[model samples]
Target chain A: MNTATAPAGPGRGPATHDIRNQIVVAATEHFSHYGYEKTTVSDLAKAIGFSKAYVYKFFESKQAIGEAICSNCLAQLEQEIGQALEGVEQPAERMRKLFKASTEAHQRLLSQDRKLYEIAQSAAAEHWPSVLAYEDRLRALLQHLLLQGRDSGDFERKTPLDEATDAIYLVLRPYLNPLLLPHSLDHNDQAPTLLCSLVLRSLSP
Target chain B: MNTATAPAGPGRGPATHDIRNQIVVAATEHFSHYGYEKTTVSDLAKAIGFSKAYVYKFFESKQAIGEAICSNCLAQLEQEIGQALEGVEQPAERMRKLFKASTEAHQRLLSQDRKLYEIAQSAAAEHWPSVLAYEDRLRALLQHLLLQGRDSGDFERKTPLDEATDAIYLVLRPYLNPLLLPHSLDHNDQAPTLLCSLVLRSLSP
Candidate 1:
């Protein structure tokens, strides 16, 4: 298979990254649809018009590919949450923004990036170590923000930060499951706003 | 197999409903140890020293047996929650009790009825209509309580009851996952309580 054209004035720079990204996206779709047990490296390679050898050139193994894709999905989620809370001064406002950003990202995963969500959930169930590490990372970020809120006197929590973070993640659990979405969820953009408002009501000082 | 003396009856005077309670306890242990996919009617019969025919006398199928077990579990949960909220006039106080009761029930499920918890979670994911119906029933109960709190002017302005109930369910999702509790989760329990408290605090007038 041939490469999909390199970047202009660059020595095969963007194409390399683009091809890897494409492979990651294709792999995510395969894992989500067929589940991790059924998805194969060959299937992922075929989807992106690349030979097995070419796919291997980017990813050392299927596990490696999964790690890369999972990390990317999580990193993007972390960024979205951070951006949502950015520049919000009020504790309550920050809390609202935090939930809105997180839920919107979750909704996007259910719709546009359905595969990523499926992959993440399935991975967490079957692949314990990697998923646990990912969970820890996410939890740490949440813990930091919660502590910040508490220090700023925005939050009046008595519980430890880790437990509080767990609470936030648990509350958002249903939103992560694709099966629980309303029939109108796809058309409804107000989900994040409504979810954020309610969550804020739950946590406001 | 022979019957287990039929609760000291005279030559078998048709085992009473209380005897049925004994069968349920035995069945719970069997299901918890063997899981839904592996446990069988014959096994349960052997465990209780009752013939398969005798076991069939009370329940129609393994599925029927499962339904009975789950119904009992939910009933116990409802009772505990009610007891926790007993004599609690204020909404916030009621919420604190509710969280404590729910956590206790959750802990019991983790330690004593793990098999049923696994079955219920899988059932929920697999779209078992009964599981969904039970969950809806729970949501309705929570909504009723929220309405009562609102009517009493104890709760502050918040989102609609149905949506808030969904948020509460989401917070409880982790304990429902068997994998998350392969070992005791006494430490993890703090998060959901804190989350519940935060939300309740937000709603306090």
Candidate 2:
């Protein structure tokens, strides 16, 4: 089998993966300076020191590039939440940490890099695959925390677990979402802390 | 002031109001077919058999017309929620009816007239004044309901009234929001009903 003759099959090769990472890095920087909607593929290609065709070879469109950047940013947020919950003894406290860490992570993106936050906002508004995947991971994490609370006799067991998890996720959505961040900020009078407390109360056995 | 010289501020006269309604109706239809983003002011004027300048006399821009339509739709939703809660004596049950009616009304708009819904979707995502006003009225209504619940011995009164209302509003936001409607639909398997129950349970003494 001639390795050179085989198709890359969506960045399967080590060299191709390296190039993809380089492209993502440069595109993120370009988006940060120029904003996601204002920056064009040609602009990204030129900034990355690659031909327009080369950039197109890596991404089908500018949206594809945006999706990649958004996915990375969201993954970082998820990791922050995971670390925030590590070694936490109480399930309710673990949930509070998750909410606080997620809100803080999103607030940083919203304040420090509004351009990147816009990418995430569009991703959520448009239902991009990256956002869908992030939401699924988040729901799973919440479900795990709920189960922990149930087993510890800290939460009611009568409500169906899956439905309760989704309901809980819905309650946290405004704070967790990029688009709804401004809405959350409007009531910045310890709203998140109080919301977490209310939700914890709902879960009490 | 001379009657002829008096400036009619924003839809004052009967004749002017009639023309404005005509423009709104025609623009709503145009937006339904071509979408809000694609349909231009010029295109709308042509459809309504009026000059572009004449259309501008009523509305400053295309977004202004969109705002008018969004305001009307949201007002209707508010009215429906009010009607649904009417005559419901139980505090928790009143909350339930409010949630159901709001969800149904939005579902109708989203499923029946997505173009109008798109106008609403943009209004919410962009934080138009219409939505801001609607949120204020909704919050006020919820506060009233919480007070009812407290007085009737149905819900706990320890949590600050305003914060609890805000938390309940957040839980219902995903389903009520046109932008997040699709996301809510994904979990449409009794998610709304269950979520309402969960919120009501949180209010238990």
Candidate 3:
């Protein structure tokens, strides 16, 4: 697990790291395509041109690989949202940006790595510990953004911060949810914009 | 399959219907207590003092019985909401009553038939056709109500009625979801009222 020891050879410089990332990416794709029950470790190894033993050396099991991929995807999403909220001063503008960024981030993921998005969706529904933990973390991040909005007078008088945060999530749940969005809308050219508008409308002060 | 089969025998009259109802009621209890996959058909039959074969005659399979029970539960819920909307007129009031009624109806089902509620929750997540059809029907019913409200000029709105309808459904989805509120508030409790208020706030002109 020593990070500095990973690319210890001349020819394998960065190749080892790339291989692991590729396996995680491929596993995510497979999980998304077939769902948890249908996906297999051997198939994932085959997809990435790695021996099953090689894959196992990097990750203990298929579920472990899935957990790591989801962890990485969600971490990147959370980081993007945090960065987007950095410069905005007004509460309402910040709230608006939060929603816009959410849709944009989601769209970027869906467009670039659709299978990974689906895997994340399936993981969210299942009772996996890692998935649930990541969701809790996401909820906390949104809560912080909402609290910031409230402090700036963007949100109206309402319940406490936690409740308000939950309300916001509730409103956007359908659109955030891969399973809930209309299939036509999911693939539509204008989906990201339309979805962002609808979400923003719900949050207007 | 005949629509006009003779009503059992002289002594069997209400007892026959009672026994059948009891079986379903007991099945619900068993399913709630043990969960759908864990509960057995024989356990249900035995709980109601009947043979497994007799239960099969009443229901072709466990899944068939589950489907029947789910339909019965949803139909009853639809009937309750339809009844609640009759004496209400104002748009806001109608929306309030709808939420209240939905909460109460879900609570009633949970209290009276927990197993069925749990089964339906799992089914809803798994894309059970019956549950999806039931949700579609419920959405249509809600749409009709929203259209009526629009015509009455009770609701102030910038969005189209269809989008508004979907938004309202999104808001109410948590309350209708037995999986989320299994142990906490009763159906007609404070959460629905609070959430509905937030939704109505968003919908106002």
Candidate 4:
């Protein structure tokens, strides 16, 4: 067995990093196709052409791999939302695009891989710190947008910033919740647009 | 044994009606003090000094009794909300009072009897038709309020009436969800008031 393929701490050579990334990619594929309950560590290792022991060297257990997948997905979502807001000077326009981008991204991801969506749901329901932290970041992003709207005179300053943030988050939950999006799509394809308009109108100057 | 005490069909004497009401009251107490899983037909029968067979005649099963309790609670809540809206001509004031009355009534009942709340949660999760019907009624009430607001020029008619109704309901979920209100109360006692103001502002002309 090649010693370079073995897992090592951070700052190790690129060989270890590559191997860890390979494991995660393979694990994600297996999880998406086979679901969490059915996908075992051995299956992930086999997909990556590594031993089960080699997989364990990097991730403590199957659950850790699932967490890593969820963390990566959330990070990617955060980045996508950030990119969507770029080049939009108006706060109202930015808010509209933000909602559109966020909802579309979530709906697209869930539709592509239902098992991955289930893992995300489980992580949220279990109150995983990583997922919780991501939620806080999302809320902060909305709060910043609301502040921008107020400063730009696009939104009236009737409600306090914090209260407005909570209100928007609560109102947009149906659009943001992946589990509910499919149902919403079936019920009304234009739900995201409708909700976005309502949210903006709520903040009208 | 008193033949009059036996369960009878509708329009049987007033005595039969009284006994049925008595059974429902006793079952509600048992289900409240003890959880749904622990409360049995025998226990209810014991509480009301009736045989288990007699209890079964009145209610097909323990679940039937729970359903009756939930139906009764929802009816009382509906009446209270109706009363709260009485003599309030201003749309904003009516909306405010409606939210306060609804939230307070739910919180009060859940605090008084947690078991009933749990049953309600189960009913929602299971998609019991009775609970679904109640939800429809609640949404209709809000829709009526929103229509009145729009007609009175208190609210701008930007979005369709149905969409606005949905937006308000989604935003107020935290206040209206029985399982969530207790936790929200623990986190912030003033959430209902804050949400109400935000909702009304969203509808302002």
Q: Best-fitting candidate, measured by lDDT?
A: 2
Calculate DockQ per candidate and list them.
0.25, 0.35, 0.13, 0.27
TM-score per candidate for chain A alone: 0.64, 0.91, 0.68, 0.86
For residue B194, model 3's alpha carbon misses the true position, in angstroms, by 4.0
Query: Which residue pairs overlap in candidate 2's backbone?
Result: none
The TM-scores, one per candidate, come to 0.63, 0.77, 0.56, 0.74
> Which candidate leads the pack in DockQ?
2
Tens digits of per-residue lDDT for model 3, A1-205: 6755332323444776677778777776676676655667888788778888888777667767777777787788878977888888776666667766766676677667655565665665553566567557767877876677666666554656666666566555544544443232322344434434444454556
User: Which candidate model has the greater lDDT, 2 or 4?
Assistant: 2
lDDT of 4 at A180: 44
Candidate numbers sorted by lDDT from highest down? 2, 4, 3, 1
Kindly list the per-residue Cα lDDT of model 2 for residues A59-116, writing each as its tens digit.
7788888998888888888888899998998988998998888878877888888776
lDDT to native, each model: 0.64, 0.82, 0.66, 0.76
Winner of 2 and 3 under TM-score: 2
Taking candidate 4, what TM-score does its chain B reach relative to the real chain B? 0.86
lDDT of 1 at A105: 77
Per TM-score, the best of the predicted structures is 2
Question: Where does candidate 3 stray beyond 4 Å?
Answer: A1-75, A83-97, A100-166, A173-199, A202-205, B1-22, B46-49, B107-116, B126-130, B156-158, B179-191
Model 2, C-alpha of B2: deviation from truth (Å): 16
After TM-score superposition, what is the CA distance of residue A149 in candidate 1 from its true location, in Å? 9.9
Interface RMSD of each: 6.1, 2.7, 5.7, 4.0
lDDT of 3 by residue, B1-205 (tens): 4533432223345866676667678787777777887777888788778898887655656776677678787888888988998878777887888889988888777777555566776666566677778778877877877777667765555678777666666566656765444523422256777677677666555
* Model 1 lDDT per residue over B138-175, tens place: 66766677777888998864466766666555444444
